[model samples]
Target: MTSSDTSVGPSSDLSQNAENFNWLLSRFAGNTAGVRDAIAVSSDGLMIAQCIEGERADVDRLSAIVAGMTSLAGGVAGSYRLGTLNKVIVDMADGYLLISAIGCGSVMGVIASKQANLGQVAYEMTLFANRAGAALTPELIRELKNHIQV
Candidate 1:
C-alpha cells in the first residue's frame, strides 16, 4: 500500500482542556491575508482542532487527509535520506496546503487562498507550528481536546 494509505498509531484517549487553541487558530487565520483555514491533527490522524466551518464528517475527512499526506511526506523524506522532515507544502492551482510537524506526534495544516501571501503565510505558519509543538505535551493535549469540538 502507499504510505498515505497507512496510519502510524493511535491517538491519545485523553483530550485537551485549553480553549485557547481556537482563539490561537482564529488569530492566525484572521491575521493572515487569504487564509482559508487551519487545522490541527494528532500524529495518528485524529482531528484535534480547526479554524473552519463544517460538520464533523467534513472535519474528520480533512483530518484524515492531512494525516495521510503527512505520513507520505515523512516516508518520502526518509527514503531519500533527508533526515527528519519538518514540513510539507502542496501548491495547487486554486490554493495551497501546508503541513508542519507539531511537538512529538502532531501536525498543523494551513490552507491558503490563491491570492494569499505565500511568503508571509509560510513564515507565520512556521512560528505557529513551533508554538503548537511547544504546547503539545500531555497537559496541553488535554487543553486542546477540551477546547476543540472535533
Candidate 2:
C-alpha cells in the first residue's frame, strides 16, 4: 500500500472535542490570505485531521510529504545544533506552504497564496496549534477508538 493509505487510529471522543481544534484552525485560516488548506499530521507521516473546503487535497499524501520534509529539516537543524524544529516554509510559484510542529508527533500546516502575510500566518498558526494540542491528545484517543469501530 502507498504511504498515504496508512491510517492512524482516532480518538473515541473525537466527535466531541474535534470542534476545539477546528475552531482554532478556522480562526487562523480566516486571518490569513490565500490560505487554501490546513491539516494536522502525526510525526510518523499519518494524517490526523484536515480542514479543506470544496476540493479535496489528498490529506494523506500531503501529510506524508510534510512529515518527510519536517524530518529532514529537523535533522539539518540538529546537525547545526539549532534546537527544535519549530516551523518550516516552502515558497512556491503560486503560494507558500508552512508547517509547524505542535507537540509530540503532531504538526500543523497551512497553504497560503504568495501574497499572504507569512509572518502573521506563522504566528497565528503556531498559537492555535499550541492551544489545540491539549484538546487533541485525549480527543485523538477517542477518535482512534471511533475509527476502529467504524
Candidate 3:
C-alpha cells in the first residue's frame, strides 16, 4: 500500500456545513493540481456534497462503489496485518480514484486525471478526510441522507 495512516477528524457540519464542505474540497483541489473533481460521502456511502462545476458524476453509483472498495480494503488490511486503512488508490488507464476515511463513518472520494500528481493528491485527500470527518456526525449523515432521494 502506498498510503499511510493520517490522524485528522471530521469538521463541524452543524453550521453552514454544505458551503464549508464545498470550500474545503475546492481548496483541496486547488492546492493539488490535476484534481478533476471530488465528492464528500458519508461513512455509509451517501453523497453529502460535490465540489465540481460541470455536470456531476453519478453520485449513487460512485458512492456505492467507493464504500464497497473501502470496506474491502479494510478487510484486506486487517487480514494481512496492515496497520490501518488510510486511503485506497485505484490507478486506472486514464485516471485515478482516491478514497480516504474521513472519520468514523464517512469518506472523501476524489477523481484525478492521469496527469495528476498522485502523491500530492493522496496527501491532500488525507487532509480532506481529516477535516471532513468532523462534519460527518450521525445527525449530519441523517441530514445529508434527507437531501438525497436515493
Best by lDDT: 1
lDDT of each residue in 27-143, candidate 1, tens digit only: 777688888777888766766677665556666777878999998988898899887757788999999988878676788888888998888888888877766667667667655
Report, for every candidate in turn, its global Cα lDDT versus the true structure: 0.70, 0.68, 0.69
* Per-residue accuracy of model 2 over 17-100 as CA lDDT, tens digit each: 665555566566655667777777766666666655532346555666788888888899989999887889999999988999
Best by TM-score: 1
Model 1 TM-score is 0.79
Query: All candidates' TM-scores?
Result: 0.79, 0.76, 0.75
Residue 104 displacement (Å), model 2: 2.2
Worst 10 residues of 1 by lDDT: 1-10
Q: Cα deviation in Å at residue 70, candidate 2?
A: 1.0
Candidate 2 worst ten-residue window by lDDT: 1-10
59 in model 1: Cα distance from truth in Å?
Answer: 1.3
Cα RMSD to the true fold for all candidates = 8.2, 6.0, 7.7
Please give the lDDT score at residue 32 for candidate 2. Answer: 62
